[model samples]
Target: MDVELFKDGKRLDGRDVEDLRKPLKLEVGVLQKANGSAYMEWGKNKILAGVFGPKEAIPKHLANPERGVIRCIYTMSTFAGLEDHGRMGPNRRSIEISKVMREALENVVMLEKFPSTIIEVYVIVLQSEGGTRVSSLTAAAAALMDAGIPMKEPIAAVAAGKAGGKVILDLNKDEDNYGEADVPMAFTKSGDIVLFQMDGKLSKEELETAIDYGWKGTEKLFELQRKAFEEEYSEPLDKKLRMVE
Candidate 1:
Protein backbone atom coordinates (compact mmCIF):
# COMPACT_ATOMS: atom_id res chain seq x y z
CA MET A 1 0.00 0.00 0.00
CA ASP A 2 2.85 2.37 0.73
CA VAL A 3 5.39 1.56 -1.97
CA GLU A 4 6.52 5.17 -2.21
CA LEU A 5 7.08 5.45 1.52
CA PHE A 6 9.56 2.55 1.75
CA LYS A 7 12.56 4.83 1.64
CA ASP A 8 16.17 3.62 1.74
CA GLY A 9 14.71 0.26 0.61
CA LYS A 10 14.24 -0.76 4.21
CA ARG A 11 11.49 -3.07 5.43
CA LEU A 12 9.50 -2.95 8.65
CA ASP A 13 11.69 -5.62 10.34
CA GLY A 14 14.93 -3.84 9.45
CA ARG A 15 15.71 -6.33 6.72
CA ASP A 16 17.42 -4.87 3.67
CA VAL A 17 14.17 -5.47 1.71
CA GLU A 18 16.11 -8.20 -0.10
CA ASP A 19 16.62 -10.29 3.02
CA LEU A 20 14.41 -13.21 3.91
CA ARG A 21 13.05 -14.09 7.29
CA LYS A 22 14.87 -17.20 8.38
CA PRO A 23 12.50 -19.95 9.33
CA LEU A 24 11.78 -19.58 13.07
CA LYS A 25 10.76 -23.06 14.12
CA LEU A 26 10.40 -26.34 12.23
CA GLU A 27 9.01 -29.48 13.78
CA VAL A 28 8.27 -32.95 12.46
CA GLY A 29 5.97 -35.65 13.77
CA VAL A 30 3.95 -32.93 15.46
CA LEU A 31 0.64 -34.73 15.07
CA GLN A 32 0.82 -38.01 16.91
CA LYS A 33 -1.98 -39.70 15.01
CA ALA A 34 -0.87 -38.81 11.52
CA ASN A 35 1.45 -40.96 9.50
CA GLY A 36 3.67 -37.92 9.23
CA SER A 37 3.31 -34.28 10.25
CA ALA A 38 5.30 -31.06 10.41
CA TYR A 39 4.80 -27.44 11.44
CA MET A 40 6.93 -24.49 10.40
CA GLU A 41 6.91 -20.76 10.95
CA TRP A 42 8.63 -18.15 8.86
CA GLY A 43 8.37 -14.69 10.31
CA LYS A 44 4.62 -14.25 10.86
CA ASN A 45 3.77 -16.91 8.31
CA LYS A 46 2.88 -20.22 9.87
CA ILE A 47 1.98 -23.51 8.20
CA LEU A 48 1.26 -27.11 9.10
CA ALA A 49 1.35 -30.18 6.86
CA GLY A 50 0.33 -33.77 7.36
CA VAL A 51 0.79 -36.90 5.23
CA PHE A 52 -1.11 -40.14 5.27
CA GLY A 53 -0.53 -43.33 3.32
CA PRO A 54 1.15 -45.03 0.79
CA LYS A 55 -2.03 -46.82 1.76
CA GLU A 56 -4.97 -48.03 -0.24
CA ALA A 57 -6.27 -45.47 -2.70
CA ILE A 58 -9.55 -43.79 -1.68
CA PRO A 59 -10.89 -42.84 -5.12
CA LYS A 60 -10.13 -45.80 -7.32
CA HIS A 61 -10.40 -43.77 -10.49
CA LEU A 62 -7.25 -41.84 -9.64
CA ALA A 63 -5.29 -44.91 -8.71
CA ASN A 64 -2.76 -46.77 -10.81
CA PRO A 65 -0.88 -49.99 -10.18
CA GLU A 66 2.40 -48.71 -11.59
CA ARG A 67 2.95 -45.78 -9.26
CA GLY A 68 1.78 -44.15 -6.07
CA VAL A 69 -0.58 -41.23 -6.46
CA ILE A 70 0.04 -37.90 -4.79
CA ARG A 71 -3.09 -36.36 -3.37
CA CYS A 72 -2.76 -32.84 -2.03
CA ILE A 73 -5.28 -30.73 -0.18
CA TYR A 74 -4.40 -27.12 0.52
CA THR A 75 -6.55 -25.09 2.87
CA MET A 76 -6.05 -22.03 4.99
CA SER A 77 -7.61 -21.82 8.40
CA THR A 78 -10.41 -19.35 9.01
CA PHE A 79 -8.03 -17.33 11.16
CA ALA A 80 -5.26 -17.32 8.58
CA GLY A 81 -5.57 -13.57 8.38
CA LEU A 82 -8.02 -10.73 8.82
CA GLU A 83 -8.15 -10.11 5.10
CA ASP A 84 -8.83 -13.71 4.11
CA HIS A 85 -12.58 -14.25 4.00
CA GLY A 86 -13.74 -17.26 5.96
CA ARG A 87 -15.23 -19.74 3.52
CA MET A 88 -15.42 -23.48 3.69
CA GLY A 89 -14.80 -25.96 0.86
CA PRO A 90 -12.01 -25.98 -1.66
CA ASN A 91 -11.49 -22.90 -3.79
CA ARG A 92 -9.79 -22.35 -7.12
CA ARG A 93 -6.64 -21.01 -5.51
CA SER A 94 -6.35 -24.00 -3.21
CA ILE A 95 -6.91 -26.42 -6.06
CA GLU A 96 -4.25 -24.80 -8.16
CA ILE A 97 -1.79 -24.72 -5.30
CA SER A 98 -2.49 -28.34 -4.55
CA LYS A 99 -1.71 -29.30 -8.11
CA VAL A 100 1.56 -27.41 -8.05
CA MET A 101 2.58 -28.91 -4.74
CA ARG A 102 1.79 -32.41 -5.88
CA GLU A 103 3.95 -32.02 -8.95
CA ALA A 104 6.81 -30.56 -6.97
CA LEU A 105 6.87 -33.40 -4.48
CA GLU A 106 6.23 -36.20 -6.94
CA ASN A 107 9.52 -35.52 -8.64
CA VAL A 108 11.47 -36.43 -5.52
CA VAL A 109 9.40 -39.12 -3.88
CA MET A 110 10.08 -42.73 -4.82
CA LEU A 111 6.46 -43.28 -5.64
CA GLU A 112 7.03 -46.38 -7.70
CA LYS A 113 8.13 -48.15 -4.57
CA PHE A 114 4.62 -48.09 -3.21
CA PRO A 115 2.72 -49.05 -6.39
CA SER A 116 -1.02 -48.31 -6.34
CA THR A 117 -0.98 -46.77 -2.87
CA ILE A 118 -1.91 -43.15 -2.22
CA ILE A 119 0.13 -40.51 -0.49
CA GLU A 120 -2.14 -37.79 0.78
CA VAL A 121 -0.60 -34.48 1.75
CA TYR A 122 -2.79 -32.00 3.57
CA VAL A 123 -1.54 -28.48 4.19
CA ILE A 124 -3.23 -26.10 6.60
CA VAL A 125 -2.22 -22.49 6.76
CA LEU A 126 -2.44 -21.20 10.28
CA GLN A 127 -1.11 -17.75 9.45
CA SER A 128 -0.59 -15.89 6.20
CA GLU A 129 2.14 -13.26 6.24
CA GLY A 130 3.25 -13.87 2.65
CA GLY A 131 5.17 -16.59 0.84
CA THR A 132 2.55 -19.00 2.11
CA ARG A 133 3.16 -21.40 -0.78
CA VAL A 134 6.83 -21.71 -0.08
CA SER A 135 6.12 -22.20 3.61
CA SER A 136 3.60 -24.90 2.77
CA LEU A 137 6.06 -26.69 0.52
CA THR A 138 8.71 -26.76 3.22
CA ALA A 139 6.23 -28.17 5.71
CA ALA A 140 5.02 -30.78 3.27
CA ALA A 141 8.49 -32.15 2.73
CA ALA A 142 9.12 -32.39 6.43
CA ALA A 143 5.81 -34.12 6.99
CA LEU A 144 6.49 -36.61 4.21
CA MET A 145 9.79 -37.51 5.84
CA ASP A 146 8.20 -37.82 9.26
CA ALA A 147 5.77 -40.32 7.77
CA GLY A 148 8.82 -42.36 6.70
CA ILE A 149 7.93 -42.16 3.04
CA PRO A 150 10.70 -43.05 0.66
CA MET A 151 11.98 -39.89 -0.92
CA LYS A 152 14.93 -39.23 -3.13
CA GLU A 153 15.69 -36.21 -0.98
CA PRO A 154 14.18 -33.48 1.18
CA ILE A 155 13.05 -30.25 -0.49
CA ALA A 156 12.80 -26.59 0.50
CA ALA A 157 11.47 -23.40 -1.06
CA VAL A 158 12.36 -19.72 -1.22
CA ALA A 159 10.81 -16.55 -2.53
CA ALA A 160 12.61 -13.84 -4.46
CA GLY A 161 11.06 -10.43 -4.97
CA LYS A 162 11.92 -7.22 -6.72
CA ALA A 163 11.84 -3.99 -4.78
CA GLY A 164 13.23 -0.63 -5.84
CA GLY A 165 14.59 -2.32 -8.96
CA LYS A 166 16.74 -4.64 -6.82
CA VAL A 167 16.15 -8.35 -6.54
CA ILE A 168 15.50 -9.40 -2.96
CA LEU A 169 15.66 -12.76 -1.24
CA ASP A 170 12.27 -12.83 0.49
CA LEU A 171 9.46 -10.32 0.72
CA ASN A 172 7.26 -10.04 3.75
CA LYS A 173 3.65 -8.92 3.61
CA ASP A 174 4.27 -5.22 3.23
CA GLU A 175 6.98 -5.51 0.61
CA ASP A 176 5.06 -8.17 -1.33
CA ASN A 177 1.95 -6.04 -1.45
CA TYR A 178 3.78 -3.31 -3.35
CA GLY A 179 6.80 -5.02 -4.78
CA GLU A 180 7.26 -5.22 -8.51
CA ALA A 181 7.57 -8.99 -8.85
CA ASP A 182 7.53 -12.19 -6.84
CA VAL A 183 9.09 -15.58 -7.65
CA PRO A 184 8.79 -18.69 -5.55
CA MET A 185 10.54 -21.98 -6.20
CA ALA A 186 10.98 -25.35 -4.57
CA PHE A 187 14.38 -27.05 -4.76
CA THR A 188 16.05 -30.21 -3.68
CA LYS A 189 19.28 -30.24 -1.71
CA SER A 190 20.99 -31.14 -4.96
CA GLY A 191 20.13 -27.74 -6.44
CA ASP A 192 17.36 -28.98 -8.70
CA ILE A 193 14.16 -27.04 -9.08
CA VAL A 194 11.09 -29.19 -8.64
CA LEU A 195 8.61 -26.35 -8.81
CA PHE A 196 8.77 -22.77 -10.09
CA GLN A 197 6.23 -19.97 -10.37
CA MET A 198 6.25 -16.21 -10.63
CA ASP A 199 4.01 -13.17 -10.92
CA GLY A 200 4.41 -9.60 -12.17
CA LYS A 201 6.92 -8.56 -14.80
CA LEU A 202 10.69 -8.44 -14.90
CA SER A 203 13.52 -7.99 -17.33
CA LYS A 204 15.58 -11.02 -18.37
CA GLU A 205 18.52 -9.85 -16.27
CA GLU A 206 16.35 -9.23 -13.25
CA LEU A 207 14.66 -12.61 -13.62
CA GLU A 208 18.02 -14.39 -13.71
CA THR A 209 19.15 -12.47 -10.65
CA ALA A 210 15.96 -13.38 -8.82
CA ILE A 211 16.44 -17.02 -9.68
CA ASP A 212 19.98 -16.89 -8.30
CA TYR A 213 18.77 -15.24 -5.13
CA GLY A 214 16.08 -17.86 -4.67
CA TRP A 215 18.61 -20.70 -5.00
CA LYS A 216 20.90 -19.13 -2.44
CA GLY A 217 18.01 -18.66 -0.05
CA THR A 218 17.01 -22.31 -0.43
CA GLU A 219 20.45 -23.55 0.65
CA LYS A 220 20.24 -21.77 3.96
CA LEU A 221 16.66 -22.87 4.50
CA PHE A 222 17.63 -26.52 3.97
CA GLU A 223 20.14 -26.32 6.80
CA LEU A 224 17.43 -25.00 9.09
CA GLN A 225 15.23 -27.98 8.26
CA ARG A 226 17.99 -30.45 8.96
CA LYS A 227 18.87 -28.80 12.26
CA ALA A 228 15.28 -28.92 13.38
CA PHE A 229 14.96 -32.62 12.68
CA GLU A 230 18.20 -33.32 14.47
CA GLU A 231 17.17 -31.31 17.49
CA GLU A 232 13.79 -32.99 17.74
CA TYR A 233 15.30 -36.46 17.84
CA SER A 234 18.42 -35.46 19.76
CA GLU A 235 16.84 -33.78 22.76
CA PRO A 236 15.14 -36.84 24.18
CA LEU A 237 18.24 -38.98 23.90
CA ASP A 238 20.33 -36.30 25.61
CA LYS A 239 17.86 -36.07 28.47
CA LYS A 240 17.81 -39.82 28.93
CA LEU A 241 21.63 -39.95 29.07
CA ARG A 242 21.63 -37.16 31.64
CA MET A 243 19.11 -39.03 33.79
CA VAL A 244 21.24 -42.19 33.74
CA GLU A 245 24.32 -40.23 34.74
Candidate 2:
Protein backbone atom coordinates (compact mmCIF):
# COMPACT_ATOMS: atom_id res chain seq x y z
CA MET A 1 0.00 0.00 0.00
CA ASP A 2 1.34 3.39 -0.97
CA VAL A 3 0.89 6.19 1.54
CA GLU A 4 1.86 9.80 1.29
CA LEU A 5 3.20 10.61 4.73
CA PHE A 6 3.80 14.31 4.22
CA LYS A 7 2.71 16.89 1.69
CA ASP A 8 2.62 20.66 1.99
CA GLY A 9 3.81 20.39 5.62
CA LYS A 10 0.79 18.25 6.57
CA ARG A 11 0.57 14.52 6.95
CA LEU A 12 -1.83 12.45 4.89
CA ASP A 13 -4.16 12.45 7.88
CA GLY A 14 -4.38 16.26 7.59
CA ARG A 15 -2.35 16.85 10.71
CA ASP A 16 0.63 19.16 10.78
CA VAL A 17 3.92 17.32 10.96
CA GLU A 18 4.21 17.94 14.69
CA ASP A 19 0.53 17.76 15.57
CA LEU A 20 -0.74 14.84 17.63
CA ARG A 21 -4.07 13.06 17.36
CA LYS A 22 -6.52 14.42 19.85
CA PRO A 23 -9.44 13.23 21.97
CA LEU A 24 -7.16 10.93 23.93
CA LYS A 25 -9.62 9.57 26.46
CA LEU A 26 -8.83 7.88 29.77
CA GLU A 27 -11.33 6.24 32.11
CA VAL A 28 -10.40 5.07 35.60
CA GLY A 29 -11.90 2.54 38.01
CA VAL A 30 -13.45 0.55 35.20
CA LEU A 31 -13.01 -2.83 36.89
CA GLN A 32 -14.82 -3.81 40.05
CA LYS A 33 -12.79 -6.87 40.95
CA ALA A 34 -9.36 -5.44 40.31
CA ASN A 35 -7.74 -3.24 42.90
CA GLY A 36 -7.37 -0.57 40.22
CA SER A 37 -8.27 -0.38 36.55
CA ALA A 38 -8.18 2.09 33.67
CA TYR A 39 -9.26 2.14 30.03
CA MET A 40 -7.62 4.32 27.43
CA GLU A 41 -8.37 5.19 23.84
CA TRP A 42 -5.82 7.07 21.77
CA GLY A 43 -6.56 7.62 18.13
CA LYS A 44 -7.40 4.10 16.91
CA ASN A 45 -5.87 2.24 19.83
CA LYS A 46 -7.81 0.82 22.74
CA ILE A 47 -6.09 -0.43 25.88
CA LEU A 48 -7.02 -1.61 29.34
CA ALA A 49 -4.73 -1.82 32.35
CA GLY A 50 -5.25 -3.21 35.81
CA VAL A 51 -3.14 -3.08 38.95
CA PHE A 52 -3.13 -5.81 41.58
CA GLY A 53 -1.16 -6.54 44.74
CA PRO A 54 1.52 -4.83 46.70
CA LYS A 55 0.59 -8.04 48.49
CA GLU A 56 2.96 -10.80 49.52
CA ALA A 57 5.11 -11.85 46.61
CA ILE A 58 4.37 -15.33 45.33
CA PRO A 59 7.20 -17.77 44.70
CA LYS A 60 8.97 -16.05 47.54
CA HIS A 61 12.37 -16.43 45.96
CA LEU A 62 11.52 -13.57 43.62
CA ALA A 63 10.72 -11.28 46.50
CA ASN A 64 12.97 -8.29 47.13
CA PRO A 65 13.61 -7.73 50.81
CA GLU A 66 14.64 -4.16 50.18
CA ARG A 67 11.69 -3.18 48.03
CA GLY A 68 8.61 -4.52 46.28
CA VAL A 69 8.93 -6.16 42.91
CA ILE A 70 7.05 -4.68 39.95
CA ARG A 71 5.76 -7.21 37.45
CA CYS A 72 4.20 -6.07 34.18
CA ILE A 73 2.44 -8.10 31.53
CA TYR A 74 1.75 -6.47 28.17
CA THR A 75 -0.42 -8.43 25.77
CA MET A 76 -2.21 -7.76 22.52
CA SER A 77 -5.56 -9.41 21.89
CA THR A 78 -6.01 -11.86 19.05
CA PHE A 79 -8.27 -9.37 17.26
CA ALA A 80 -6.27 -6.27 18.08
CA GLY A 81 -4.76 -5.80 14.66
CA LEU A 82 -6.48 -4.55 11.54
CA GLU A 83 -5.75 -7.55 9.35
CA ASP A 84 -5.18 -11.11 10.58
CA HIS A 85 -5.81 -11.61 14.27
CA GLY A 86 -2.74 -11.77 16.45
CA ARG A 87 -1.92 -15.04 18.17
CA MET A 88 -3.23 -15.40 21.68
CA GLY A 89 -1.00 -15.62 24.77
CA PRO A 90 2.38 -14.11 25.54
CA ASN A 91 4.89 -14.11 22.73
CA ARG A 92 8.55 -13.12 22.83
CA ARG A 93 7.71 -9.58 21.78
CA SER A 94 5.11 -9.27 24.50
CA ILE A 95 7.60 -10.54 27.06
CA GLU A 96 10.15 -7.94 26.09
CA ILE A 97 7.60 -5.15 26.16
CA SER A 98 6.45 -6.30 29.57
CA LYS A 99 9.97 -6.21 30.93
CA VAL A 100 10.55 -2.72 29.63
CA MET A 101 7.25 -1.53 31.05
CA ARG A 102 8.19 -2.91 34.46
CA GLU A 103 11.44 -1.04 34.39
CA ALA A 104 9.76 2.19 33.31
CA LEU A 105 7.33 2.13 36.22
CA GLU A 106 9.72 0.86 38.88
CA ASN A 107 11.45 4.19 39.14
CA VAL A 108 8.32 5.99 40.26
CA VAL A 109 6.70 3.46 42.60
CA MET A 110 7.62 3.60 46.27
CA LEU A 111 8.50 -0.06 46.39
CA GLU A 112 10.53 0.28 49.58
CA LYS A 113 7.31 0.87 51.47
CA PHE A 114 6.19 -2.68 50.74
CA PRO A 115 9.28 -4.78 50.90
CA SER A 116 8.80 -8.47 50.17
CA THR A 117 5.60 -7.62 48.30
CA ILE A 118 4.72 -7.45 44.63
CA ILE A 119 2.91 -4.95 42.46
CA GLU A 120 1.46 -6.52 39.32
CA VAL A 121 0.39 -4.47 36.33
CA TYR A 122 -1.43 -6.05 33.40
CA VAL A 123 -1.99 -4.22 30.11
CA ILE A 124 -4.16 -5.67 27.38
CA VAL A 125 -4.54 -4.13 23.96
CA LEU A 126 -8.01 -4.65 22.56
CA GLN A 127 -7.26 -2.70 19.38
CA SER A 128 -4.17 -1.18 17.87
CA GLU A 129 -3.35 1.34 15.19
CA GLY A 130 0.17 2.09 16.34
CA GLY A 131 2.06 3.18 19.43
CA THR A 132 0.26 0.53 21.53
CA ARG A 133 3.19 0.21 23.87
CA VAL A 134 3.18 3.87 24.80
CA SER A 135 -0.61 3.96 25.05
CA SER A 136 -0.54 0.91 27.28
CA LEU A 137 2.05 2.51 29.50
CA THR A 138 -0.10 5.58 29.95
CA ALA A 139 -3.08 3.44 30.86
CA ALA A 140 -0.99 1.40 33.26
CA ALA A 141 0.11 4.53 35.05
CA ALA A 142 -3.48 5.63 35.42
CA ALA A 143 -4.45 2.22 36.84
CA LEU A 144 -1.58 2.41 39.30
CA MET A 145 -2.79 5.77 40.49
CA ASP A 146 -6.36 4.49 40.72
CA ALA A 147 -5.10 1.75 43.03
CA GLY A 148 -3.62 4.48 45.23
CA ILE A 149 -0.12 3.15 44.72
CA PRO A 150 2.44 5.39 46.33
CA MET A 151 4.54 6.99 43.67
CA LYS A 152 6.51 10.14 43.06
CA GLU A 153 4.14 10.94 40.20
CA PRO A 154 2.35 9.32 37.30
CA ILE A 155 4.16 8.74 34.00
CA ALA A 156 3.02 9.43 30.45
CA ALA A 157 4.31 8.25 27.08
CA VAL A 158 4.18 9.00 23.36
CA ALA A 159 5.67 8.00 20.03
CA ALA A 160 7.40 10.20 17.49
CA GLY A 161 8.89 9.25 14.15
CA LYS A 162 10.51 10.44 10.97
CA ALA A 163 8.14 10.14 8.04
CA GLY A 164 8.80 11.47 4.56
CA GLY A 165 12.16 12.63 5.92
CA LYS A 166 10.43 14.92 8.36
CA VAL A 167 9.94 14.48 12.08
CA ILE A 168 6.35 13.86 13.05
CA LEU A 169 4.53 13.48 16.32
CA ASP A 170 2.52 10.38 17.24
CA LEU A 171 2.76 8.28 14.12
CA ASN A 172 -0.34 6.26 13.30
CA LYS A 173 -0.25 2.83 11.67
CA ASP A 174 0.44 4.05 8.18
CA GLU A 175 3.21 6.39 9.23
CA ASP A 176 4.73 3.73 11.46
CA ASN A 177 5.21 1.29 8.59
CA TYR A 178 6.54 3.90 6.22
CA GLY A 179 8.49 6.00 8.66
CA GLU A 180 12.26 5.89 8.75
CA ALA A 181 12.46 5.98 12.53
CA ASP A 182 10.23 5.63 15.55
CA VAL A 183 11.02 6.71 19.07
CA PRO A 184 8.88 5.80 22.04
CA MET A 185 9.43 7.58 25.34
CA ALA A 186 7.92 7.71 28.82
CA PHE A 187 8.36 10.53 31.30
CA THR A 188 7.26 11.44 34.79
CA LYS A 189 4.94 14.38 35.36
CA SER A 190 7.96 16.50 36.15
CA GLY A 191 9.43 15.67 32.73
CA ASP A 192 12.02 13.17 33.94
CA ILE A 193 12.67 10.47 31.38
CA VAL A 194 11.90 6.98 32.58
CA LEU A 195 11.76 5.04 29.32
CA PHE A 196 13.23 5.58 25.88
CA GLN A 197 13.47 3.25 22.88
CA MET A 198 14.22 3.76 19.23
CA ASP A 199 13.58 1.58 16.20
CA GLY A 200 14.78 2.10 12.62
CA LYS A 201 17.61 4.39 11.60
CA LEU A 202 18.08 8.06 12.39
CA SER A 203 20.83 10.64 12.48
CA LYS A 204 21.84 12.16 15.81
CA GLU A 205 19.95 15.33 14.94
CA GLU A 206 16.85 13.46 13.73
CA LEU A 207 16.77 11.33 16.86
CA GLU A 208 16.97 14.38 19.05
CA THR A 209 14.13 15.99 17.12
CA ALA A 210 11.99 12.88 17.53
CA ILE A 211 12.64 12.86 21.27
CA ASP A 212 11.71 16.52 21.49
CA TYR A 213 8.44 15.84 19.69
CA GLY A 214 7.81 12.90 22.01
CA TRP A 215 8.17 15.17 25.03
CA LYS A 216 5.58 17.53 23.57
CA GLY A 217 3.20 14.64 23.02
CA THR A 218 3.68 13.36 26.55
CA GLU A 219 2.97 16.76 28.04
CA LYS A 220 -0.44 16.81 26.38
CA LEU A 221 -1.16 13.23 27.44
CA PHE A 222 -0.30 14.04 31.04
CA GLU A 223 -3.09 16.59 31.13
CA LEU A 224 -5.59 13.94 30.10
CA GLN A 225 -4.24 11.56 32.71
CA ARG A 226 -4.68 14.11 35.46
CA LYS A 227 -8.16 14.96 34.26
CA ALA A 228 -9.14 11.30 34.28
CA PHE A 229 -8.19 10.95 37.90
CA GLU A 230 -9.89 14.15 38.93
CA GLU A 231 -13.13 13.24 37.22
CA GLU A 232 -13.06 9.75 38.68
CA TYR A 233 -12.86 11.05 42.21
CA SER A 234 -14.73 14.33 41.93
CA GLU A 235 -18.24 13.13 41.27
CA PRO A 236 -20.40 12.91 44.33
CA LEU A 237 -22.87 10.03 44.72
CA ASP A 238 -25.82 12.35 44.33
CA LYS A 239 -24.31 14.06 41.29
CA LYS A 240 -23.60 10.68 39.72
CA LEU A 241 -27.19 9.62 40.32
CA ARG A 242 -28.44 12.84 38.84
CA MET A 243 -26.35 12.30 35.72
CA VAL A 244 -27.71 8.77 35.44
CA GLU A 245 -31.23 10.12 35.77
What digit string (tens of lDDT, one per residue) describes model 1 on residues 1-245?
Answer: 54552556565577774567854678887786678888999989899999999899978887888999999998988889758556846988888999999999999999999888899999999988888899899999989988889999989998887866677878887667788888889899898999899888889999888888888888878887898789778865321122233
lDDT of each model, Cα atoms only? Answer: 0.84, 0.88
State, as a TM-score between 0 and 1, how close model 1 is to the true structure: 0.92
Cα lDDT tens digits, model 2, 32-114, are 76788999998889999999988889989989999999989999999999787557789888999999899999999999899
TM-scores for every candidate against the unseen true structure? 0.92, 0.93
Q: How does candidate 1 score on lDDT?
A: 0.84
Clashing pairs in 2: none
